[model samples]
Target: MVVLAKAELEQIALPAAQPPMADVRAVDLSAAPGPDRAAAARTLVAACEEQGFFRVTGHGVPQELVRAVEAAAAGFFALPQAEKEGATGEPVGYGCKQIGDGGDLGWIEYLLLCLTSAGTVPAASFPFSTLPCAAVCTERELLEEYAAAVRRVACGLLELMAEGLGIEPADTISRLVADAESDNMLRVNHYPPAPRPEQQAGRLLTGFGEHTDPQIISVLRSNGTTGLEIAGRDGAWASVPPDADSFFINVGDALQVLTNGRFRSVKHRVVVSSERSRVSMIFLGGPPPGARLAPLPQLLGDGGGRSRYREFTWMEYKSCSHRGRLVDDRLRPFEN
Candidate 1:
């Protein structure tokens, strides 16, 4: 709902203390690489090949802005129940109300905003990023400013991804230039302290549940919290910690599919602490509501560039996802 000029900010860059494995090293590498684009590109390729995620340094988003947003989200969620509930309920048909379920929760609040003025409301206005925030925090321009600034970083990333694929990075990213479905979202997720065990069930039954991103990719900035869990290659879950002044990158289903499994969309969840609160700013770049999603030309393995799957919009995929059943079940259909 707002936009800010890129000129009003200061950024600091830090080196990757060590080489990362298909991972974001909690540094800044957004619109421009910290040291060298070619070096950053190699790091990015290595990350997606193995880790499927990475932390970027030198993206120009201020750690202060990240702190401010997290603080605002915490303060907003800490408001009285009535105030918090005012922004809770959401339309069901669009699967928005699911965010409000699991009641008697901690003081975490959420706010989402749809950047593009595409196909009118009533049909598809319930974007996941624009969850409502407290009125006090609503008036601040930093949220929107941060979004626009990060968008540039996203564009740069997309193009870099293209280059990593051995194509003209600009050519692979052409669809994003004027495409309505090349969407981006910003969210402020707050986690308030939990009561004693007698009063709360703790993280397993509270806070945000386990979920994988539905976008092409997600970039996150979070305060030092240990609740995040990553499923390692052994099918075991490992707790992922936060590094100071860095962004976390994770691939989404769309990117995974488009890249013909070259990229992976991993499942992650937040575990709320019984004592300290947590807040994080998340940005997801996904295809538009109805943008057709399928494997990309270069990522396809065989048939001289044949795609492996049919194209489906995110809404379609989500509709099937809401059924809570795997779309491709083992029950074989009769061949005619």
Candidate 2:
């Protein structure tokens, strides 16, 4: 847990090429619009194998929609405390750190919404009838649009990953993880300004403790505020500065399970800034609630025909993740 000033951040020297904790590859989706997907696939695969994280640009998401979502988030968080509290619920709604599960509160507030309905899937099929954004209608509209846009990008990335793995993209991993009935959650995190900007040991504290996401993939967009950090291959932490031009794509525990440990699920944390509030939107993709997950047969090799992990349902995994402490690999319990 360290905070570096702008001068200090600039002073830290990194390797000329392939820096230890700072190398997150960026891929342009629009580079080859005609299905000749050589360049993007190579970069995407390499990034996933190296760190399970990358930046994506030319993703075709409208800038106006992004801005509208950001503005709506800001407005929603600015509402009265009671108003925010009205949106609080179990897995889907507003949550303040002080009232978090087991009292291990992070110094942040969030609104979680379930987005399970798609084409042909009735809107009533989801867990919640309406989003927590009833406080602001525009927020709901913008968030729904943003979620669809992000989902498209996620699916496209999954297709590239499938091609990289030399597998059937539409019938295997991508299909399973992004199925119409899959459990998809959107998290809107609001890290309020820290009360003490002068504190040395506990500067801003941590918005969220270090942990790997339990879903298949996470697509995140930040509002130009630095708070996220990812652990590198050497167990050292590197800051991920906010880049408006791209979304930070992170592989999650479910993906690692599907890849049989070839692709990693990076460990990351959010560190708050004492001087400014920060907002980030994250879209989570995972298997259907009742779907049983394990290392794909195609991914398993000739180790006496053994799999790295035992089969487990998405519901069971989600329960394990929420019940246990948020640290280290949450998938270890199911490892064979």
Stretches > 4 Å off in candidate 1 = 1-35, 88-109, 117-140, 169-178, 198-206, 302-306, 325-336
Clashing pairs for predicted structure model 2, backbone only: none
The C-alpha lDDT values of all candidates are 0.55, 0.75
Q: What TM-score fits each model? A: 0.73, 0.85
Output the worst ten-in-a-row residue range by lDDT, candidate 1: 7-16
TM-score of model 1 (CA atoms): 0.73
Q: Write model 1 residue lDDT over 260-332, tens digit each, in one string.
A: 6677666665655536766676776766667777777766763346654567776676555544422122111
Off by over 4 Å in 2: 1-21, 33-36, 98-102, 117-136, 169-171, 198-204, 302-305
